[model samples]
Target: MSTAHDDLDNEHTILPSWERNAYAWTHSVRDGHIESRRMVTDGAIIDVILDGEPRFVLDLGCGEGWLVRALAARRVRALGVDAVSDLVAQARAAGGDFRLASYEDIIAGRLSLRADTVACNFALLGKDSVERLMPAVASLLEAGGRFVIQTVHPLVAGGDHPYSDGWRQENWTGFGAAFPSPAPWYFRTLASWVALFTRSGWHLCEMREPLHPGTGRPASVIFVLRRR
Candidate 1:
């Protein structure tokens, strides 16, 4: 039977949509309070990253550079990379070490950067990008380095939707004027996430689902993987 997942699988990339709306998105999340981030995701992701005691961190797809700035405050060398020019500019303006580069550019060896820890905070949005970027991520880390990822939990984020893979539109109902357009993000099942990492030569060291304090439902999932 035809399903939403099947429909999304047939669609092309959604990068252009994000590129077009980078400014609004960046402005929305600049303060870092965005409910979920303030309540759970921020602490969970930062705790995992700090536990590794990495000297250098590459914050891949670091939208407004909040994570990078936080890492720098901890005396770690951190750099943020984002494809969106406006977002990158905002990050730079905020005194963050940020570069305007896409995941595809990094994967294709156009940008050279290696780190003890590479973190992607709520940035791994598409199936195509994840598949193409995983191998390059494996290569971009120091030996025994870790890759920490914080993404929307597939189950909670999917809610009552079909579990099949596909693209889903962002829920911008409460975001107000800051979010002008809803960007469609690709969704993958938990099995798909694990398989992708395993196939890319990474061993999962830890995984945790951060739950919302109010509802006890998962707000996001964190994965700590080490190159093997």
Candidate 2:
């Protein structure tokens, strides 16, 4: 039986608005002081990857490849893939290994790169993207490999915004002119996130809500999953 979520998944399409401000977004997080990243996301994701001790990591939707550079510094083999050419170019300029490929291409069986761990940081924004990428993620990981995702905490993301399964425009309040055409992202509740992972044949292994250092509020949520 197809549920409402399934119906919505089939209807939604990928948004390319991120490409508009790719340069700005890349530069913003390059130094890693962008509130959320500095507060918790950076440490949380790196800790998970180090704990897994994987030979290689495939950073899906790796905008600008900051995480890839970080992992490479630790001598961990890491490759970043993103749809935006400008972002990939910047990553390469920063001495990071990055490929220009979209999630659509990956889901369609176009790219054939596998790794022991697949990490997506704050990139799973759309329901359609998630639905399409989940199966491809399974194919990209080795046996017993882990998939780590760090995204905005639903509770925090949905505080003022509606708490439903739909797309919402980014609050470009603090981003300044760097983020001109902010892209809208799909907001999924905690339960919805877990349900999507479960249906995609992933076992939820660990979950954490990293708090903001200054405000002490939940900044983002990290989920670690292993293929079942």
Candidate 3:
């Protein structure tokens, strides 16, 4: 799911990105919109791998590969890939072995490289799109490898569904982000996400939704999956 950046969806997707569109790539992935990813990509993601002690990791939709660089610092064998050119150049310059390709291409068996673990932090993948990308992600891993993905919670991402109105009243929150016109996100519930993961051939081994520290409720859904 290419957020607002990808030109695929004309409708306002619940996946609101920082920039207006994927074509607008001058700013960083963190620069445009949605502060959620900053937290998701920073320590939370690294913790998943670091704690698990994954020997090899692949950063899906790696963007500029900041995460990959961080993974490298842990001495983990990590690789990253993205669909953008300049970002790929930047990632390489940063000493990350970043590739210029989409997960779809690699998943379709178009690429030769593979990894032991695949990580996707705050990447948006549509229902069908994830199906296509999953096998490729799984393929990169050795047997019993891990696949970790994070995205907008479905409850928050509900803004993506086709609506009769321009933007539905129920589709927004103060922090919610939309697609197309920058409406809000299409948030999925915990059940919705679990279903997607099981359908994608992953079995949920653990789940975490970090809170705002004082609210005592989940702030976001984080899942650690293992290939079944």
**Clash numbers, per candidate:** 0, 0, 25
lDDT of 2 by residue, 1-228 (tens): 335775464334334577788877876786543777776889889998889998999999998888999999899999999988888888899897889998888888888978999999988977667787887798888899999999989888886756777677675655434676756677888999999999889999999888887889888899999998
Taking all chains together, each candidate's TM-score versus the true structure is: 0.91, 0.91, 0.71
Which clashing pairs does model 2 show?
none
Kindly report which residue stretches of model 2 are placed more than 4 angstroms away from their true locations once superposed: 1-15, 31-33
Q: Give the per-residue lDDT digits (tens) of candidate 3, residues 1-228.
A: 334444245332423342343333324343534344454436677887787778878887777777888888878888887765666776787687878776568767766765667888765444445556765566677788778776655444444664221222222233333323343333345676677678778889887665544444444666888888
CA error at residue 42 for candidate 2, angstroms: 1.2
After the best TM-score superposition of candidate 3, give how far the Cα of residue 203 lies from its true spot, in angstroms.
1.1
Instruction: Give the lDDT of residue 170 in candidate 2.
Output: 79
Evaluate model 3: give its TM-score: 0.71
TM-score pick, better of 1 and 3: 1
